[model samples]
Every structure is written in C-alpha cells, then in structure tokens.
Target chain A: MLVHAGNSRGAMRGERLCPAEVKRGLLDGNPWQADPSLANLSGVADALAGNGPAHRIIIDATASGEVADYHAHWLEQGIHVVTACKLGSGTTLERWRAINDAVARGNARYGDSATVGAGLPLLRNIRDLQAGGDTIHSIAGVLSGSLAWLFNHYDGQQPFSQLVLQAKDAGYTEPDPREDLSGDDVRRKILILARAAGVPLASDEVAVDSLLELAADGASADAGLEALDAPMAERFEAASAAGAQLGFIARLQDGRARVGLERLDATHPLAGGAGTDNRVAIWSDRYCDQPLVIQGPGAGAGVTAAGLLDDALRIARSTPD
Target chain B: MLVHAGNSRGAMRGERLCPAEVKRGLLDGNPWQADPSLANLSGVADALAGNGPAHRIIIDATASGEVADYHAHWLEQGIHVVTACKLGSGTTLERWRAINDAVARGNARYGDSATVGAGLPLLRNIRDLQAGGDTIHSIAGVLSGSLAWLFNHYDGQQPFSQLVLQAKDAGYTEPDPREDLSGDDVRRKILILARAAGVPLASDEVAVDSLLELAADGASADAGLEALDAPMAERFEAASAAGAQLGFIARLQDGRARVGLERLDATHPLAGGAGTDNRVAIWSDRYCDQPLVIQGPGAGAGVTAAGLLDDALRIARSTPD
Candidate 1:
C-alpha cells in the first residue's frame, strides 16, 4: 500500500507516486528530492501519520538533523524507525537522549544498525555485550570506508594526491573530498560507537586530529589534492620505516573519543583491510583478554540498502502484523 | 516470588527456597534430589504448572535429554525457557527440531545464548547474521574455555598432564577430565553454532577428532591423566618446533562440522587467550574479507552464572512482567 510519496526536486506527490512509480523513482539518484526541504520531509511524516498505527519509516536520507527531529516525533507517535543516518544518533548527547526517551515513551524500536558499520552489527553487538553484563572499556577501529581504502592503498607507492583523486573518482569520497578529509565523518562514527558502548557523548567533545589543515584556504579539489601529497608522503614513509601501517583510527575509551591517523603495527586489530573495509575491536570486561573484532565492508549503496532492509525486517518480525 | 526449588540429592520440597538458600544449595552441587530421575523431573514440572498460566523455566541442569524433553513440554504450555544446557539446543537434529517446533507452537522464547561459548554471544551473532541476509561461509574457533586454557598454557615447558590436573583442580574441566579431552563438548558446541548458522546438523553427524582415544577404557582419573602425558608431550614439542600453537579447534564449513586439535599461529583469531577464554571467527558475505572475531573467557562458574542471569533477564524483559 503506497501511503504517500513526495520528491523535493521534481513534482511528484500523492496520486502520481504509486508503488510502481516510487520504485522506479528510487532506482536512480534523488532527482525528486535534490533539496530536501522541511516541507517535503514533513510531508513524508504527515503521509505516514495518516496511515494510522503500526507504521515503520525507513530513513535512508543523510540529513541527520531533520531526520532525527522527525524520528523523535514519529517514535512519540508509536511509529518505528530504521535509519542509515548517523546524524540522528551521533549529533548531540541531548538529541540522542531525546530519541531514546521518545522511543521508550511510545514503546517504539529505533533501528540504527546501518548507522555505523553499514550492514555490520557493530552497534547491536555493543548493545548485546552491555546487556550481557560486559563493561566495554574501549572501542578502536578504522571506521570510514573511503578513508580506509585511501590509507590502505596509499603506502607512498604512488603520489597520495593521485590516490585521493582516484578515491574521489571511484565514488569512495564525498564529492567535496574535503568533507571526508576533515575527519568529521570519522568523529561522528566514533561518537556513535561510543554511545552504543553506553557513553553519551556530544559531537564537539570528540578530539579529532584532522588532515584537512594541510589544504590551503579556498583551495580547489585539485589544489587540495596536490597540497596533501608532501605531508602524507612523509607520514606514510615514516610509518613504513617503523614497520607500521598508517590507519585513520577512531578510539573511544575512558569516557573520551578520539579520531586521527595513527601508525599501526601488523599485530594491531585495526591494521588490516583490503578496500573500504571497516574493522572494529571492542575490549570489554567479558572479552578483556582478546577483544571481540568485527570487520567488513563498512560502506557502499548495496550494503547500506541491505542494512536498512535488515532493520526493517527485524522490526517487522518483532512487530505484530 | 519463590516458585519451587529441588535438588536430586535430598528431600527438600514443598517449601519454597529463598535466593540465598538456593545459592548455598548450588554451592554443594545438585542435591535437592541427587539423581534427576524422570519422575522427579516430572514432579518439578508439575509443581511449576500449579503456579499459573505464564511461567518461565530456568534449566541450569546438564541433563540434556531430560531437560530438552521438558523444555518442549513447558514451551508447549506457553511457558518460556531460559537455559544454560547445550543438550537442549545441541542434541540430535530430530530432537532439536522438535524443541524448536515446541517453541514456535507455544510462541515461547528459548534462551540459548549461554549454551555455546559460555557467556559469549556466538549463537546470537550467527542468528543475527542470518537474519540480516548475510550468508555464513564458514565458522572456525577455539570454543572450549578449559581446553583453551590448557593449550594456551601448555608450551612443553612443563608436563601437559600436570596442566590438565591443574585445570581440573581449578574447576575448569568436567569432573571426568576425560569429558574435556574427549572433544564431545566442543562437538556439541560446533553443532549448536552450525545450527544457529541455519544448518540442521545431528549430534553424531559431526566428525569429531577425539583425544580420548589415548586413554584406555575404564581408566581411573589418575591413570588417564598419566596415560595422556607421553602423547601430549610429543604433540606440544612438535607444535613448538613448527612455530605454531596447539589449539583444540571446532570448524563448521561446507556443511560439515569438525572438532579436533590443530596448530595455529599468533595471527589466528583463536590463538590468544590467557585462561579459559573462548575465541570465535565468523566469515560471512557481509564480513567476507576478514572474519568477525569474538574472543572472551569461555567458561567459569561466575561467568556461567552471569550468562544464565543475562539470558533470564533478556527473557524477563521481553516477556510480560
């Protein structure tokens, strides 16, 4: 049953967006929702609300701020939420607490399985560990798929600039590339993971050692890419000489979160990944000696879709038909 | 809310035992009635049935055949089950299927989290992976905490039999130490894991490579411990010379479950464990590149108690108060 469909870009709404039309529309980019205005997003919520009770909303949009606001509202209305957006869960400690409180108040489930590790069960694992009476001491990982791919391949073999350009061309990095290089995404992921481990952390609280400072002000993508070569080359060269690999690592420990590039030895848990793989090692009271590690492709459209569906199916199975 | 309590050893019935009393009783072993005979087991069930419609049974007994039989009956009565017994989940495929059918028919939850990997989330992880549409290619690990401790400590520096004796003394192994060496527990665990991964495997169907063959039939504990020295010495020496550590590994792959001794390097997921720690690595499509690895203390009285409570609390939270 198609309840309601609205696209921000093109004029498609109500009668025009049947099940078939919506399916075809989602096949490509968000032509209908290029600029997801507040009216368009609220239109989605209003349509879902009109459908009565027991409705589930799958938020695949990355606008965490707007999506989280709607998520809180919908959850308060006893509607379930499954999201791939980290911003909803990763924005601020206050918002995080609000979402949780809303879900509790309405007895709704908020599925954030795809928010951190794509389709991997990193958040769920952390939650289960906590439920099992395991005190999670720390979590460290290479979280960003784009950053992991770039670092894993950028061993001073070729100019680091070329790899950054190649990664951008491969659709691995954000279009601006600066967004990924800024370390904000990794910081958000670390905070998300930290929250899952029972740590309520605000966005600005995380200490992010970014590589974006190397890029000069008002530099274009090409200029920024070229400027990063010298510094990155030195970092990679030093790491190799020390028998260590350079990894963009995120660590949450002792009530603090840190994200930065680190020199990891071969034996380190986060030291291995082929391409765009996110590997996390969680050290806890129960898993104290050898941390529980989960590694896999952390990003990509296919995996994100799988994660969203997985969360939806989970809610469906648990919710009464 | 003291419902009922009984030990197979003595006549302590009709009066409900308090939490402290039950703790004291468990300290000495199962003695409320010594032998968990069929009639006594049935009587316990009957007493619980008299309580009310919605009842949850926590079976901490090791009597696989009997507990599973009763688990089916209780579940059919709409009574939930939280258990630390592997037999209920690890028995023959037919019995396993029967229990599952009972759970489904009664719409009752079966808590099997503590059955394998002691308190670790091995079974749950496998189930979640399957539910998330990820195909598990294979699973391999050091599942037995007693064996993990034994192998981890035994480096040919001291007599292997002495380490076995120490492990037994520390309450790490089954009373008959032969049970640990027999690989039956590991086989059951592998079968439990394989079933959780969507493979309906019979208990006997597993190709378990046993170490018990070294001990003569009807040998005493001392005699068996003595007989194990020479073969174990040779094995450890060989493993050391080859620069590999010996691990009692359980593997389920290509629709086959195997349990036996194998050599593992430091890089192996199951290689590192201080004392009675169980480590597992799961390979699936989502986690295809590098296996999802979980490591922790696999066995201990305190840890097992924690697992049972954890499972019970999970069931309690899910079920209506």
Candidate 2:
C-alpha cells in the first residue's frame, strides 16, 4: 500500500487512498484533496520516516530539478529512489558523485533506468559491462524521439519546417519545438550514457550542433520556419546523393561526447531504426567487431512508468526482511 | 578471494590459488593441482559452507545437467548461482520451478543472463516488462548463432552443405553440426524466453521444424550433407523472389512456442540483423506497434565470461552487508 505521495504541486498522506482510484481521479482531473499537514516535501519526508522496516521508495516521475535534488537526501536516509528525472545523473558530475556516495554510505539502491531511453536497458547494459571488466570504447545513438521522428519523416519534397509542425501537432515534440531542435535533450542523454560508461563528461564538454540555428528570425513563426527548409533540403539531398541517411546522433568516444546531425551509410547501425525508434550501439571490448545494438520506442509515458515500476519491484525483491 | 572451485572432472580449494595464475594455467593447458578432499560436488559444497557473512556465489560454466541438479541445493543454502549453462531454466518445468522456489526460500539470486543472448539483456527486459505489469503479446527471434550465420551467409550461389562446412571450420557450429541443425537449441532458447514472459510452456509443447529432417542419410558424412543443398537452395530462391530473407526463427505467441526456418520481409524487425547476430523482437502492450528489438553477436567465450562476471557483480552489489 502507498503510505505517502508527493509532487511539485503538493504532498499528501496516501494511507486512505486507493491507487486505482487516485490514478483515475488524476487522469480525470478530479484529484484527491491534499493534506494541509502534508503539503510540502519536508512534510512528506517526515510522514515517510516512521514506516517501520518495510522498504520505502520515492518514485520521481517529474522532470523537476527540485525533486531530483532530494534524491540524495532520501537515499542517504535509507530510502530507495526510483526516478525518471535526468537531473539526478545527467547534470553536474558533483551531484552524480554525491548520489553514488550517498548510496554507498546509506546502503541504498538508486534506480534511474527511466532517465535514458525510457526502459530500453541502455544504462543497465553499460553499467553491467563496466562491472564485468569490459572496457567501453564508444557509444552512439539516436537518443531523442522527437528529433528521430522529425528526421525519419523529413523528405526533400516536404519542407523540414512542415515536418516539425506536423510533429508538434502530433504531440511528438515539446510545446516549443525549439526545445527539441536545440539538441540539448540529446546532449543530456549522451551525458547520462557516457557517465554510465564511466566517462566523466561535463555538460559543457559536449559539442552540440543545434537544428534551431538553421532557422532565421522573422516577424512570423512560419516564416522563421521557412528559412529551415532550404538548409535542411540541401543536407538531405547531399546525403541522398551519397546513398546515406541523415540522423541526429549522440556519440561518446574517448571520453568526449557530441550531439549533431550526421549523414550515415545505409548499412550504419543508427540508420536502420524505424519511425521514432531510438537505436543505440555500444562498442566495447567484448563487442568490438560488431557492436551490440538495442532499438525501441524511447519516449512514452507507459514505458517510463513501467521502468519506474520495474525498478521498484527489483528493490522490493532484492531487499531482505 | 576465490574460495572454492569445482567442475565435472574435479574440485579445488582456492586458498593458494591466484585467479590470474589459474586463468594463465588453464589457457596454457597446465592447471593447478586438485585437492583430493575437494574432488567432488559434496566436498566443494562442504568447503563453501561457513564462509561467514560474505556473499557466496557458484559460477556454472559447464553444460552438464548434473551440475544443474545441484543449483537448487546451492541456492537453498544461500549461495547465489551465476551461470552460462542453459539447464537451470531451459530444461524441465519442474527444475525451473524448483530453482525459483529455492531462490525465494533461501533469499538467493539466480543469474542466468548468460543462458539466453550471451548477455544482450533479452531475459532482463522480458522479466522487467512482466514485473512492471506489461502484457507481452509475442516474442520472435533468430536465436542460434550457428543457424543465423548459415542463413545469413547462404545465398543460392553456394551449396548449403559447403556453407555448413565453412561454419564448422570457422568454429561457428557445434562439433556435430547436426546438433545446431536439429533446432533443439533454438527450442531451449524459446522456452527460456517464453517462461520469462510468464508463459509456462513445456518443452514438448513447442513445435520444432528441424532442418535436420531435410537432409538424407548417406554412407559418407559429406554425402549426407549434400542432401541438404537442394531444399535449402529452393527455399532461398523462393524467399529471394519475394524480396525476403530466410532466418532460423524461434517464436512464442499466445502461450505457444515454435522454432523453424522463416521468410521475413525487409521491413520486418528481425530481418535487419547482419552476420551471426541474434535479433529478438518483443511485442508487448507498451510496444504494440513496433516491437522492441535487441541485436548482437550471440556467442563468444569472452562475452559469456563477461556475462557470468556481470551477474556475480550484481549479486555482490545488491546484497546488504
């Protein structure tokens, strides 16, 4: 049973709450009343403190850095933290080190599987390979689902801006398509993967080639979008003439990370993925000749939630009474 | 830190043994002396006992059912078992149940990642998906490294028998190539995956269309292999005419499992793999339209050892002090 629930909005004691009902109420925009005594993170933490020996877990489904900030504290208190937020391990190296140190100091588990590639087992595979004494030489992937969709559907016939608009309309991109086009999301993902592969890559160390720069400032949004057409079309046609496909790739090799648009051969590992699929290739000592490739739907609420639940189940099962 | 070691041939206490020395000795075909007191399984088990609070693990690298029989006993005694052998979960349903029950009863881990895709995260993904409440609809793959190589390399140009000989020469097939041609290994893999997906499919329930049946018996081994050429060539031609590729496929759907040669379209998820890659496509409620695909080199001694080491590390890390 759930003992406590909290979000950026508020916190509540979940002793009287039914999970199914709570889910329905939230989905229907008729949420249960928040407790006056449990309206903040500190209140929720206090309520979660005295829950006997049963394993305590905090499922952070939000993208808030505020929530991620408490991950170390919660873990240091012997509470397991299962998070979908990237700020935990994808941000500053200091925070990542703190979390690891806290986990060791308090003997807690940190489940961040949902932070990268949704639930595709990318991070787990990297960590496991490292644990097994395999040296990871490089890692590359189409890390962003929105960019993948845009690139996969972008043809020279249709303006790239039109495809971006369609992707936005389809709810595939962020509200501001610029956020998706800026290439920062892919950068974060690469940092997360690189760090997992034992590379200490800072956010600034990654060189990003932003798609947003292809557009020009104009009085209207559509006009600004039109400036992107010629540049994108030229790149696409050049790639096509060379018998290659264009992909927004995030790569970490020799401890340096980069995210950019690149033309890849038809036989390239990243070029084979279908619509919106995030394809990751890992080059390690064990898989040096032919890299291990994992491809799947990389962005979905259901999958992310499932990843969180999977982590929770693992913690619950691995913990002894 | 090595405590006890045993194999079908003998056993030894590792008090005076260095792991690097042992590895070099075995590779040089000059092994350390075996202790007579630790020459058998029971003797090794007795020595493994009374190791205080440190996590105990038994790494099974052999393909012997006799060794598998002791898995439950070891697990029940709170000794974790990390294995590359298939007998633990790929054999009888009773043995599978016994192992799982023993894990629960003894609070021990059973690391069988090496049993499936040589540590490609196939089993981990399936089990995690189930744990997270996702309903798996189906799973299909080209499972056998030997068969994958044969089919991937077999064009109508070369006789199938010649390719089999080449595969054998390349160390890609079993000593008796018929063991690979029999489809039983694929059957075991399918059974293991199906069981992981919550389908309790018995071994006999799987309908295996063995490729061995296509060859006729002859006085000479080469003559018997020659009989396989025509049928395979015809199938190859037929598939090529349809713009499809032939793959040795193992599939589980609707709680039924089957292993056979399949013709797949270019767009099929499992059709894109190259060389001896084991490509598995998983269909689940979360991945309904596009199956999650994992592809990689499925067989190698280094990878198998890395997988065993990975499982051992996980058991060690997850266990509380």
Candidate 3:
C-alpha cells in the first residue's frame, strides 16, 4: 500500500515554479540556455516566462550518445535528473556505483524505476542483496519470454525457422523477433546485472558465445525478423535428444565476463522454472551460505507494462530531492 | 566504483560509535534517568568526566511516553533536547528542518530514526505520490513479520501452544507474542501509516478488529495461545481458496483509522506475497485509475538493519549544510 505516500510534506517535494521567480532564477547569472543540448529546454524556459518553475522534465531522444550533453547541462543548472539512456549494450535496468556517483556529484536526486529493474526484481536485489550477505557469482536469466518459449519447444528437432514462425504468430516474439533470438539482448541484460554486482564491465565487453545463426546478423531492428520461417527443429534434434535444452547463461568469474549458450537439463534451475517464467540465479560469496535465486515473469507486454508502471510508481514514491 | 565519492561525506556514515562513546552518551546528564520508567543512568553519569559544553540530549519516547520528562530534566541542566514533547515527529528526521528547529528551540538536535519513516520510504513515497495527482485511500500491510506469520500459520493447525514460543521461533514477537497478535502491533503500524498519509490520527483512535478467540481469554500468554489457535487457518484457507491471500491490513479512510486482518485477492494487490515480505498498498483518490503498491522486506534483522545503515549512509553522503 505504499505506492506513493500522500504528500504530507507537499511544500518540500517538487519545486513550485513561480514564473516571476523562475525568470529571475534564469537571469540570475545561470546561463543554461547557451548550451545547445538545452535548446529543447525552450519549453521549460517558455513555461517559466510567467511566475513559475518547472517541477520535472522528460526527454526520450530518438538516438543514443546524448547522455553527456544532458548530464552536463543539468549539472550546471543544479538539477535533479531521472533519465534512461539506452542499456549501454549491458544491463537493462540497474544502478551501479556510477549512478550513486552521479547523485553525489550533481548534488541532485535520482530514482529511475523505469530504465532498470522494472517491477521484475532486478534493481532491488542489487540494492539490498548485501543485507542477505548474498554475493552474485553468476546470473542466468530468461529475459526474453519469446525466446524462452521458442527454444523450449524447438529443441533443435524442429526447424527453428518454423518454430520461430509459429512463435511470431502466437505473439510470443516481438513484431521483429530477432532481438529475442539473437542473444544480444540477453547479453545486454547480463551486462546491466554485472555492473549492479559491482563488476566493472560493459555489455560489449562480455564475450558472447551465441547459439544463433551467424547469418542472422544481416537483419535490422524491424525487417530481418521474418527470416525464422525456415526449417529449425531438424537443426537441433540430436542435441535435444541428449537431454540438452538451449539456455543462455551469463557468468562472471575472476574478473572475466562470459555468456554461455549451453544445454541445461531439467536439474538446472533455468530448466526447472515452470512455464515461460524468467528465472535468475545470483551466485555471490555473501548470500546466506548459498546462491540467491529470483524468478518471475520475464516477458509479456502486460508484464512489461506493469514493470514500467512499477518504475513509475517507484518514481512516484521517492523523494525527488 | 561508487564508493569513494569523497571522505567529506563518509565520515558521517559511521554511526557505529565505540563503547566509550555509548557509555559517555548514556552518562552525560543521565537522559534515561530523567524518564519515569527508564532504569537509573548514574553508572554512565559517574563515568563521564566533566566534558565540553553540556552534551545535547535527545530522548525519543514515542513508545515510552516519557517525552515531557526527558526534555524537562535535560533543559534544566542547560543540556538541550529536541523531543516529541515539543517538536513534531517529522522535524526529528527532516535534517534541515530538524536542525533549524533545534537551533530555534535552543535544544540539541534530538532524534532517533525509529519514530519517523525510519529509512524515509514513507517520506519518499509521500513525496512521489503527491507529485503525480495522488491521494491515499487505504494502507494495508504486514507491518510486523512475526505477527503476520503467527496469524497466517501459527494457530492450532501448527500451534506450538504459545505466542511467545511462536514469535521467538519467528523472531521479535516480543516477550509475549500475544501482544503482537492481539492487533496492537498492527494498530501502531496503522497509526504510522495514517500519519504518513497526513491524516490526523492517534493510535487509540484506530478502529482495529482483533480476531483472537474471545472465548479463549488469557490466563497466561502460552495457555491462552493454544486455545486460540484452532479456527485461525480455516479463516485464512477459505480466503485463499476464494482467490485471496491473508494480510494484516491497516487502513486510513476519510481521516478515521482502523486495521483488520484482510483476505485480499489478486485484485487487492496484497496477495501472492509469500512470506515475511512487507507491502504497502495505497488506493488513492489521486491516482484514480489504480492503486499504488510498494513492497519490500519490511521488517527484519537484515532489512531494517540496512534501513538504519541507509540512514547513516544518507547522513554521510549529504552536505553538512
């Protein structure tokens, strides 16, 4: 019941812009408008023309590489930010020390419940895992539900092509399902996770030994996904018969980062998870003398929507300052 | 990587005082001695050699009801205190506000994190919920794990024949777990929730419906517990079968307060939680579309300990002002 606490202390929460005051603040030697990145801030500036201040701002750039400009402008303006730059080819939704550093350096506040750790239990685990004395040695996840379902029944006996086509029709895969099958998304998620565990590594830095076809690289975000209509089960029948199920594993050891495309049996935590649910195993030195396992819905538009809302709720509930 | 932002802030995070400091604080002006029910504090008093300006004494008597005496005794000795007796509750944790009030009242900054939102999730939520047109309807949660597990699983079905025994097995039920299960713990929790929601509420005014077996009126903590245990499960199981889960719910409705044991289904959002996980569900008038949920390890040796440490960390991380 603690989504957002009622504003018992409303006056202290967000800035109540008095147009006169904001204009004054703007002219009071804070030359933020000169920054090219803030050209979009014209909306905020125009809004401040009257006696007012902007309580918050949101920007979703169509591209990447804009984080530096955004952070610099805000830092100079002494602003609080909650931005979700892309996954950086690593983790999806997580806060490593880099975030904490940003919070400190800017003398600003941040709560990005959206970008990382939607409602699915990623960020909170990282934020509070130490409480359980749990350290994460490995994190194996079924991040893409479509992939999990496709690979589960495919077993390489069926042409992955037909199975992927079936998955597309079932709405299990994204409209462009390539992201779900290529293992790149999984690698990015692993990177986000490693950073959360205090492992200093980038998503691209992790060596990914993928099980997907190398020819799939020719596909774009939207177009190439239809390539899965070919025969696929015939490709993996023998491996499937060997009690091997395709599972993507992200592992960290002795400062080396790696992603494994392996066959996990039913005994594996990944294989044992019921349904298309996402299961994650965190191996750490600190967890109560064993590994910490967190499992839940890994996919579904509804679940992702809920996760976004969860982030919204988290943002809604935290003190902006 | 986020660790050494700077020593400028880290020094404040060291809430872990040496034994000498603890002894010194206890003896300085005998803060506890001034409280009516508190044991004498002379042992500490005798140990402190005359020190610098009389120490600032802060006594938190939210539970003990000793606020008035705490301030009076310390104030008379030219030692200062900021207490619930004089300043309001939020002022105790609102660092800037607390310091301002302490200086204004000519008292030492007196506070313990226990009384307020503890780790400020309440305050943070309050800040967030208010920002996005949100009003709280009800707050229901298992504020205490011991009481929740006791009520959920402890009755005759698994009765050990005693509340204390059950709680001890669960941790922190009290010298008498009966007090916890009897609705008082949830009542206090409701009061806090109400206060967080900005409702003017008092603990006694909370409308609590206790489910203990009325016929099994206590002769002793253990004896009455066995008599009380039998019917509890059918009540919970029936709720679960009907697509609901059990939770000790604290509700704030229209400025009045009350708490009850709830058999809430998935619609209630408090369902599906397994064990010892604490949740706050706020159905607000503001966010009319849906209720907001904030779930976490609410009460625990580890979670709360992390919370306390987070408080210490916040202090260490903030500017000294």
Candidate 4:
C-alpha cells in the first residue's frame, strides 16, 4: 500500500492515491494535492518513520538537491532510500560520505543503481568487486546515451547541428540540448562510478571537454548551429582516416576522472556499442588483462522505473521482518 | 573465521587451516587430512550447523552432483550455500524447485552467480529484471568461453580441431575438450537462465547441436583430428560469404532453450565480443527495440573465486546479526 507521495512543491497522504489520477493530473499540468499535515519534509519523514517490523523505503526520483538533503536524515531514521537522483553521491565527496555513513549508523540500504547507466549493473558490479577484495585499476565508458547516439549517427556527411536537432526531436536529448552537450551528466556518472570504486573524486576534479563548446551561442534556438558543422566534420574525417570512431569517453584512473571526445579504434571496448547504448569497461586486479564490459540502453523512463523497482525489491528481500 | 573445509573425499575443522598448507598439499597431490568425525556429509553438516548467532555458510566449489544433493538440507538448516557448482540449479526442474523451496523455508540464500558466465552479471541481471516485473522475451548469448575463443580464432585456414586443442592448452577448455564441444555446458547455462526468468524448463527440453558431432571419432586423440577440417572450413566459408561470424550461441525463447552454432551478423548484439568474452543479449518488455547486453570474460578461476566471495559477502551483509 502507498504510504505517502510527495514532490518539491508539496506532500500528501497516499491512502486514496491511484495511478490514473496521478497520470491525469500530470497530463493536465497539475499534480499532488497539498496536505498541510504532511506538507513539509519532516512531516513526510515522520509519516514514513520505520517503527514496525515491515521495511520502509523512500524512493527519490527527483533531481532536486533539497530532496537529496533529506536522504541522510531519512536513512538515519532507519528508512531505506532508493534514489535515481545523482545529487546524493554524485555531488561533493562529503555528501557521498554522509549518505554512506547514515547507512552504517542506521543499518539502512542506499540503492543508487538508477543513478548510473540506468541500472545496467555497473554500480553493483563495481561494489561487488570491491567487496570481494578486488582493487579497481580503471573504469572507462561511453556514459551518455544522447552523446552515444549523436556520435553513432554523425558520419560527417550530414551537418552535426542537424544531427543534434534530430536527436533532440527524437527524444534522445533534453529540450535544452546544451544540457546533454555540456557533458556534465557524463561527469556525474563518472564521479559516481569512481566513488563506487573507492576513489573519492570530487565533482570539479573531472576535467570536462564539453561538446557544447564546439557550438556557438544560440545553437539551441536554431541560429549559430552551423558553427559546429566544420569542426565536427574535420574531427570525423580525421578519425575516419585513422580507421577510428569518435566517441564521447569518460575515464577514471589513478583517482582522476576526465570526460571528452576521443578517437577510438573499432576494436576498442567502448567503441563497439550501437545506437544509444552505454558501454563501460572495468579494469580491476582480477580482470586485469581484459576488462569486464557492460553495455545496454543507458537511459529510458521504463528501464529507470524498473531499476528503481529492482532496488526496492532488493532492499525488501534483504531486510529482515 | 574459517569454520570448516571439505572436499569430495572428506572434511575437517578449519581451526588450523591455512592457504599455504592447502597449496602445499595440492602440489604434493594430497589435499585434505580426512578427519573421521567430519568425513561424511552428515558429519560435515553437523560441523557446519548454525547453532550460534553467527551466520553459517557452505562453499561448494566442486562439479559433483552428489554434493549438490545436500544443498536443500543445508539451506533448510539455516546454512547459506555459496556455490560455483552448476549441478544445483542447472540440473533438473525438481532439484531447482527443491532448492528454492528450501531457501524460502529456511530463509537462506543460494549464491549461484559463479554457475554461469563465470563471475559476470548475466544471471543477476536476468533475476533483477524479473524481480522488477519485466517480462523476458528472449535471452541469447555466447555463453561458453571455450567455444567463444575457438570461433573467434577459427578462420577457414585453421582446422577447428587444432583450435580446440589450442583452447585446451590455453586453459580455455576443459582437459577433455569434448566436454566443451558437446554444448552441454551451454545447455545447462541456458536452463539456469530460463529458470531464473521464471521459465520452469526441464533439462531435456533444450536441444543442443553439439560441435563434437562434426568431428569424426578419435578427434581428440590426434589420429582423426583432421576429419573435422573439411566440414568446419565449409561452414566458416559459408558464414564469411554471408558476411556473418559463427558463434556458439545459447538462446532461451518462448519457454524453450536451445544451444548450437549459429551464424550472426556483424551488427548482432552477441557478435561484438572479443577474446573469450561472454556476450549476452537480454530482450524483455522494457528492452524491446534493443536488448540489454552484458559482456565480459566468461571463465577464469580468479573470477569464479571472486564471484563466490562476492556472494558470500552479500549473504553476510544481508543476514541479520
């Protein structure tokens, strides 16, 4: 049964909630009735406080830092937090430590599988390897689905600007395509992976060579789009001449992270994925010679929802009644 | 702390056990000290019985069906079983059901990640998808490391038999190369995966087209090794002509499992792996247009050991103190 549902705007009891009502409200551009008794974060937390034998879980699906602030508090209250938000562990190293510390202090689980690779087992594998006493040497990946699609289809024959617009139209990118082109999403993912692999990499430590810099200002508004065409065409031609593909790569090694566009050989692990696939190669003490690779649809609403549900199920199974 | 150690021959207390002694004994071709009190299954069970607050775990590293028979009993007695053995869940439907029943009855976990894809996350992903309420439409993969290695190197110029021998020498295949060529290992893996996806498929239901049949008798003995040359060369040529690569693929679809050699296009999800990598494509309701793919080193002692340790750590963490 639904205990409570809330968003940044307000909170409410979920006793009489139904998916149809929620969907209708979302379609009508209005959602969630404000209940004063449960309107604040503390009220919601109090409603979700775990005092019974049954496990209590709070799912964080927002990108709000305000909601992320409640993660440690809720976890410390013995409430499990399954989050899709990157703000928890992908922000400052201090916040990452706080979430983990809260888990230890309250014996609660923090399921952040949906934070990276859309729950493709990347984080789980890294954590499992570390738990098994394997030292992670490096991790490299094509972490951004929008960038993957962009590079996969950018053959230099078509203008790169046209391709970006096409990708945006196809729902492969955000409405503000600059958000994807900025490479910050990839930076967050790499940070999450690095921290998971025992490296406390701060957000600013990752040197990002964003694709957005290639486009002139007002590129998203259909003007100045041609600025990206010549440079991108040149890079594609150079990569083709060397029998390589251009990929937006995120790398973490020696406790450092970098995200940028790179020319990778066809045989490279990160260069083998198709369409919007997020392919990652993990190098560790055990898997030293050939890195362990995982690839799949990196971003989608259905898969993300499935991932959150998977995390919840895992917590439910692990928690003792 | 080490509680007990055992093998097919006998078992002993782990109080004074050390890796050095085990290594020396193995080098000397004499492994265990055969204590009579812990010699048999029941004696070993009694020694490992969960009497205290501490969690009890049994690690099964053997390929013995005899040892697999005790999984239910040990689990029913509140002892966790972390196994690399395929005989437990990859066997008959009845045995698989019995193990699950015992897990539910005693609230014990059966860690079988090492059973398929060595230490890769194939089984875990399939399980997580199912747990998240996603319907698995199909799962296809190059599940055998030995076969993957063989096909990856088997140009029409090289004799398939020579490739098999090379794989054996490289430790990619079992000492008896026929075991790898027979396709039975892939069959067992497909069965395990199918069952994990909620398909209660029997062992006999999988139709395996063994590569061993291509070789005339005595192929492993060098006397008739060249007998496989013509057929394999012809098949390889046909696949090349069709712009496809030959892969020993295991597939589970429509509640059925099949293991055989199939010609896959360059763009096929399972066709992109390198050097003994186990590449798998999982098709489900959520991942319909494009399957979720996972690739990694499919077989290695270190990875298998790591998988077992990972499982043990999971159980230890999950168990309430």
Top candidate when judged by lDDT against the true structure: 4
Best by TM-score: 4
- Give me candidate 4's TM-score against the actual structure: 0.91
Over the true interface, candidate 2 deviates by an RMSD, in Å, of 1.7
Docking class of 4: medium
* Model 2 chain B poorest ten-residue lDDT run: B27-36
lDDT of 1 by residue, B1-321 (tens): 445554444323333556676656644665653334523666665655664435456455454566566777677766677777888878788778877898777567888877887677778778877887889989998889889889878878687789988998888888888789989889988988888888888888898888766654656767877777778888878888887789999998899889998988755655655677787888888666666777667786656666777777787777776
Q: Give the whole-model CA lDDT for all candidates, comma-separated.
A: 0.76, 0.83, 0.48, 0.84
lDDT of 1 by residue, A214-267 (tens): 654646757877788888888888989999889889999899999998999875
Can you write out model 2's per-residue Cα lDDT over B1-321, one digit (the tens) per residue? 577665554455655467776554444445455444465775656665674438878889988888888899888888889988898889899988899899878578999999988877789878777777789999999989899989878878989999999999999999989889989998999999998898988889999998877774542466778888988899999999999999999999888999999999876888866677898999999888778898898988877887888888888988865
Task: State the weakest 10-residue window (summed lDDT) of model 4 chain B.
Answer: B23-32
TM-score of each: 0.82, 0.88, 0.56, 0.91
User: What tens-digit string does per-residue lDDT give for candidate 3 at B89-168?
Assistant: 32222332334344446433333233332231444454345444456776655566565555545333464455447467
**Cα lDDT tens digits for candidate 4, A1-321:** 456776655555664467665555434446444444455776766665555337888889888888888888888888899999998999888888899899878578999999998878889888878888899999999998899999989989999989999999999998888788889999999999999898898899999998767764646545656677888899999999999999999999888999999999867877776788898999999888788888888988887887898899899987787
Compute the DockQ of candidate 4. Answer: 0.60
Q: How well does chain B match by TM-score in each candidate?
A: 0.88, 0.94, 0.64, 0.93
lDDT of 3 at B202: 50
Assess candidate 3 and give its TM-score to the true structure.
0.56
Clashing pairs in 4: none
DockQ sort, best first: 4, 2, 1, 3
